[model samples]
Target: MNTQFVVGESSSSSPHLSCDVFLSFRGEDTRKTFTGHLYTQLCQVGVHTFIDDEELRKGDVISIELDKAIEQSRVSIVVLSKNYAFSSWCLDELVKILDCKQMLKQIVLPIFYDVDPSQVRKQTGSFGEALVKHKERSFGAERVEKWKAALTEAANLSGWHLRNVADGHESKFIKSIIKQVLQEVNQTPLDVAHYPIGLDSPIEDILLLMQSGCEHEVRMVGICGVGGIGKTTLAKAIYNRIFLQFGGCCCFLSDIRSKVEELGLVKLQEKLLHHILKTKDFEVDSVAEGVNLIKARLGSKKVLIVLDDVDHRSQLESLTRERSWFGSGSVIIITTRDEHLLYGLTTSEIYRAKLLNDNEAQQLFSCHAFSYFSPPQEYVELTQDIIKYSGGLPLALVTLGSHLQVRSVKEWRYEFKKLKAIPHGDIQKILKISFDGLDVNTQSVFLDIACAFHGCYEAEVIETLNACGFYSESAISTLVQRNLLQRDWPSLVMHHLVQEMGREIVRMESQDPGKRSRLFNPQEAIDVLQGHKGSENVQALVVERRALKGVKLTTKAFQKMINLRVLKIDNLYISGDVELLSKELRWLSWEGCPLKCIPSNFPVEKLVVLNMRESNIQEVGLDFQCCRSLKVLNLSDCKRLRSTPNFRGSRSLETLYLDNCSSLKKIHPSIGNLDSLITLSFSCCKKITDLPSSICQLKSLEFLDISSCSSLQTLPVDFGDMQSLRSLFA
Candidate 1:
């Protein structure tokens, strides 16, 4: 007896002699002979076998040791005899086996054992009779229910089950099951491909560009538009188009706002290097060094690179240099909201991406809201109203439409009314509705970019966050996985509207202007900087009544934040003695501050705008030499400003307003250097001017308002160069 036990134990435990065949049978029904024949055949093939012993176990309970033995076995051979469900322990074992299968992703092979699967599922025939008997027994309904559920679950799983078969062919079925399992173990799963959002006709253009080859210097295509108008979508569409055509290509979807807030650009550069080189390990310690390395490695390869959702021109300069940095045939695609961002790059290479037309918007909306090609009869009116509110913006349309999908017409109408009634502060209110559905961490990151930082460095944010004792890279990664935060070229950026909306939330929460003054606590600062926390307070550090005086900054100081939507440091000083006018800020407003000039090499590319509307500045120098991304330069009422600077390289300058510069005389001759200039208003600049012939070179110029330029008389005869001039208010 001891020797028999030893043999059984050795068969079950030995690695080489492990159970090659496990018999799964109801003890009272077929364990006596049917399993015996199967075991004999398996043993003949030098396979170890495990057969449950009914006598070894206590009454009504399955032995714990037996359960473990069954779980560890390589394969289970279930005997579905007529009386299978009669044994309660058998039902328990079957449920455990199915649980293991699901948890471990194990292979399961079922045998019909002279009974059909249909009977097992429907609990008909002998199986039904056994369940009925149990229900009628002293055992309660709950116990019977458990057994029924187990049987139903096991029967539902996809596996091999036999019916109307004999012991003679049992070996053949077992061998076939083993062979199939082995084959499955050897095969690898395929990697999932990313789907490009908003792909359409633009794909054709990208394909054509690829087919044309490197004959001409590789062209850089710029897709410029307002936030959420599908700039990133169009670029993604283009990327997907060429990804298959080219042997080497990389799409860097970095958001400048989020990167500066989280990891900084250094980590982003490292990721870019690793992805481009196809290496698992790489180091990019700084932005300058990373830029150099990227240029060196990518300079020779005829590759396709895409930088999506850019907010700053500095981001463009930092990532893709002159087309010369790449091979002759390489292609670079950049997407941004600010048209001024395309200035430093070639004008001929830029493409102003427009929002989707009514038909397209409606179709996109219908896809999300109705789940059909068109709106349903009941919700048609409400859908149209919702579409109108979206203003042909794809992101807004898709988001709002998705929320309304499958909802009742009443719900749709109510939502539409609420959206229409709400005042438009920033795009964040609309975005927050979507963001609120995300996990807490994602919401925190979204608000961080909207409130405290933009164009952030990923690594710096991470490092600063580590100091604050908030380590949740996984949570930040999860946000990226969900597409809430995106990588925009070398840095990270939030959607323009998203940032705007986030700031709005921060402002709303900080109802008291005084509370806004002390919001940036160190912990809160790190959260705001690294995109891990939302601002609960606001602190506008005003410099001076005439010039900003030193104001206490929150412990979380701005070190590497690159993108800021609204920076109103009115009359605030950096130190008690030094002036703080030289800081690189976007949307800077020193209304009454005593300041002279902006800092040189101040990363002007990052400013999608500059608003110094009401400032007391006498010497207004035109040293905007590096502010390539300055789309709108508002020097509205600077009465002391006398002469504009030579903006030769501000090629992306779309709108230049020198309104009310009463003392200003001669306009910069290089003002005509703007090829992409759409709106040039020298309104109220009473100083004399015989406009230069170079102004005629603005073939794409539109809305040229020389209104109130009393000193100006005859128009340039070469005005024929303003072919695209739609409204000339002279």
Candidate 2:
């Protein structure tokens, strides 16, 4: 076994190794002085040492107890102080301990305090004179000879010499002893995860891949996965299992990707060299120098190195780039989120880590939340719900479980309800690392999908995002590869935890709605509007649910939103003085709009999209002066009377939806002048309609849906100019 334990290495319950160390000191010589301090230091470091407490026990049963103590302890610490040989009780204990050491292969450490080892070995000074006093006592000569032999053997063995090393600092001396003994007692590798469910199978698979079978060959293995998927934990376990066998020169370099930015490559290279070379003062001025030193010095030594969470190829180049960097039989293992970093490496193997399975996730979560595998009888159903929401991600499961562990059931219900809207902060912090690594444009697209278009069709989301200038096609692919986003058939599906992280990014913009980039909370929105706190910072405002309490606002409510772009206000009823919607607005989706017309004076100069579906509108807005940028205008389900507006100058309009407009009457003569029009929908518009001669001018229209227009009479004669039209619904 290695001298130091890694995290998560639990001790086996063996009776023979029950006591960690047995303390043997002469009571009259050093019991109250050096030995007492040593025993206290051992206890502080969590060693199970058997120190003889003279104040607690009587002299009658002392010998029997001392014999049992030495028998159970795995290590015997014999403090050979001056006058140590004077007591028959001490000599008897020493003989028994030395016999156990030979028979059981137990560890023995002797401390020669203020006394020479030669004196103890030859029995010449204080020890020899004490043996003469023992000769006149009732003890037999055979017993005295046996005591002399035990002392000679122990003093000859290499051990701590206090007079030569301590320099009058007894505390420091005691601490040094504790350090060595602590390592011997707890030699675990790493604090393995709290619940290592489904851990053995993956580690076994990695072990198979790591097997090179020949001492002349070197092996490099990669463990790849998304963030919080337990890649680091698995890598540590693998390193702990086989690291001790690799000539005792091993280094576990963790957080390579995350820490390199804070602790530069030069520092990391220095650490790798120092750890594997077993030197403290090794120095290199630059990363290149460090790299050279590592290659030159460690080339002939068989080393084991675990490079954890490597995001870039440069980190590999500096640490362990090629198999020739180390001696034969050396092993190099790397854990990373990007598998591309190991693409062209020589003699490489990859292990793809996956999220925990359902059973494993439940077990892992139970360990964190309830201190057991499975919840209490009363919390069974609730714990299962928590597991389903976690989607088998171990980080999410453990984080959520820990958060709800000490809370009452009622509190759990309340917190779980809140999580449906905003995720747990600790969970978001971990998942956000993947999100934070994206570029600005990709991050914007992710936030859009997370906030509004999560369940929307992929095509529609792409079209809308393209119109808003967010390049999402490649960004979506990147997200999918990172396991942050997934695509369902019609709509995109993001893990609930990942989606919550995206929302959290927007939430962090500002607590006040006016200063936020996006506003979704109903109360915050109402407070912003009623208090006239709206600012130009807001880009999107979505009222997902109806107004809990009706809010009152004025015309100035939205006058400050100079940079507002998107609005999806389907719910909250904000009634008061009408405000001129911001001219910078691009996408306005106000379903069930209460107004008949959005007042012509409300300039929509930069509007790219507009939807007032299911409103009480009668006439189209007469403001064509500043609407040259309009791309989409949907008046669907507007029951009131309406007539199509004449388009003499608003040429940028692309999509026109008049579906379910029950009272539509006339088509203006210039209705066909929309040269940039792409989609035209007149479905369910059961009003009088006749083809305008100018309709054939829409050469760019791709989709034309005129189905259920019961009153339509004749088609345009020269419609052959509509060559770009792909689908027709009539």
Candidate 3:
């Protein structure tokens, strides 16, 4: 059943009208063919119809009763035929029908029966020749113009097109027409979100951007946002609000991203033309031909087109390439997850679909979960927890909220625990598509952040990962654009759910603690370390701040871990004759090393970053070894340090942080040759410092920090020789 007939059995929802349908057609044209069958179907279905079949004789005037019937009818069905306009009586009747439509605000449906609507609209073919005859008969030029205007107006309406739809089967066409009739008569509302929240602002913003100084100019607007952010809903709302008011063709092409594969681009193009032109079965065998056809046909008509869920720029290239493709006052709206997809589109602004705020999220979730605007007192706290995890994403909120509706509060608590452990499948499935779209290297970077580096500095993560042999420098921007990562002024931020999704992916690698690629949880790390059950597959690991008491690791604990690339274990308790770290290790951050110095056997050629911030272990190597690839080395707060390392082999070093190494220090004159260094920090090194004249030779250095050096210092006379310097902190 059509949604329109959801009320009383197939009747008009309005009770103020007298007759159900008023049929206006020519007796010789469609009285026995199309109109006759239509009337039979209407009457058989209990539709009270008032059709004036009384033919006036030659040169006889039409009775006033015919005019009365047109006035009393709720709907006027105008059937346009080849010879229908040849009769003066039919033209007079059409004029009266249109007048009643304006005065009574009646519903009007037009059926093009065996006649070209274009011929009727532009007064061109048989209809035009007949109108010329009417003029020759001196029916008055003004009266003839009125008849032509009425035909144009009626043909433009959304109604049946027989030649395009029903070439041979009239019965099938009649059924479709009746379905449309019922749909038109229906007063039922459309299907949309029950509680649409946080949409008014975006709608208002987009509409403002889409506005032109003149209504006669074609305008295009793009809505860019991530998945599950309600772009489609916003587009639908905007379409519903302005579609009918345009008095032209309106089309909303939805699910363009997922549907293109099945329906093909050519079919979508055909549908676009058919819906706007009020035709059916319009065929397009190729997208190229469809493009030409659309450009040729829709150029003169004002149209409202909303292309929803567009995932690629190619879709836009094929459908709406330019403003000139449509007539004046036309509007084209597109929605896509990638803002770059809308890159060169001719629009002033793009509206980004924002996540709901706290109150709105609560209310929306409540509607789906509790079937109302608020939750029960018992489940309020649990619902808040779920909302926090959802982070204002509409699809996640709705899905999780609805899933918890039938469960008890205790069950909600249990389900919340499960959601925290593993993300809701519905939410994760959609989010994973973004992850799955990336290449292997970018996916690795994303998982590294999710599992180990969520709160770390963005630069540090990028520099460290790039050192660890994962290309993260450009991938970060891609993740940010995809909405998986957000920039928080100085640091990077990942949604908690997205982070969990990455963690869950890592967990799926293996159920055993030692078999995973990375381990972040304290228990998992502890189990793997204490049991000496490490594996080569565990490439990265972080056992952060707190610990289960007394867990220890021997130096040989990492012997089996040949593939480890990153290790950041802070304040961990471990002591042993540590001889070897895997040769693959690139960045090592051990805050509290129980050993006196870094293991001599640790590979230096591959080591890119080494951080021992706030650690015990005074002396660095007397001479920096073959660490040719080292870009960053942070030993901030190494209180036992007495001297800087030799700069013999540290030429590639870019950033060297020695902040808060409060013990006495003496500079190595060899440090002056480090021309590749960009950032060199010596803040809070309270010990004495002397001049190294060669330091002035570092022309490539960009950042130099020497704050809080409480002891005396002498400046090199030629320090000003460094020309590439951007910032010098003294």
lDDT values, one for every candidate: 0.58, 0.77, 0.77
lDDT for model 1: 0.58
Ranking of all candidate structures by their lDDT, best first: 3, 2, 1
In model 3, the clashing pairs are: 618-640
- For model 2, residues 1-730, the per-residue Cα lDDT tens digits are 2122122232211223458899988877887899988988888878989987665334522466677788777678999988889877778888989987765545688999889999999998999998999898757899899989999999988788887766857887887788667645553356657567778778767777776355566778888776788888888777766654553477888888778999889989988887776566767889789878888988998888999988777899898888888998788889877656767554338887877888888899989999999889888888888889998888888898888888888998898889887888778877788877789988988888887777766765665677668887977777775667777987898877787788788888876668987776777777887788888888777666456335445557787876777777763454544445666566677777767767666556666667788877787765665787787788888888478876677778888888888988777777777888899988988885776878788889899898999989888888777789899898
The deviation in Å at residue 313 for candidate 3 is 3.2
Per-candidate clash tally: 54, 12, 1
Please write out the lDDT profile of model 1 over residues 86-199, one tens digit for every residue: 877777677776665554333456666777788877889999999888777756788777778777776776656553333436666656554443433222211111222234
Backbone clash total for model 3 is 1
For residues 1-730, write the lDDT of model 3, one tens digit per residue: 1111011111111223467678888888888888999989888876778777655423634567777777767678888888988877778878888886665556788888888788888988898899899999898999899989988988888778887786747898888877766544432223447677666677667667766446677877888776788888888777755553344377788989777888878878887887777667568889899889889999999888989888776788788888899998788988877776777765466787788899989998999999888789988888888889889999999999889887998898888888877788888887776788778998998998888778777877887788777789888887886777888866887877778778888888998979999988777888888788899899898877756445666657788888888887777767764446777877777877665666555566777778878878766762355787787888888888777777886678888888888884787778787878888888888885665788888878899888888784677899888898899777
Better of 1 and 3 by TM-score: 3
> How does model 2 score by TM-score?
0.62
TM-score of each: 0.36, 0.62, 0.76
Alpha carbon lDDT at 43, candidate 1: 69
lDDT of the structure predicted as candidate 3: 0.77
RMSD of each: 21.6, 11.9, 8.3
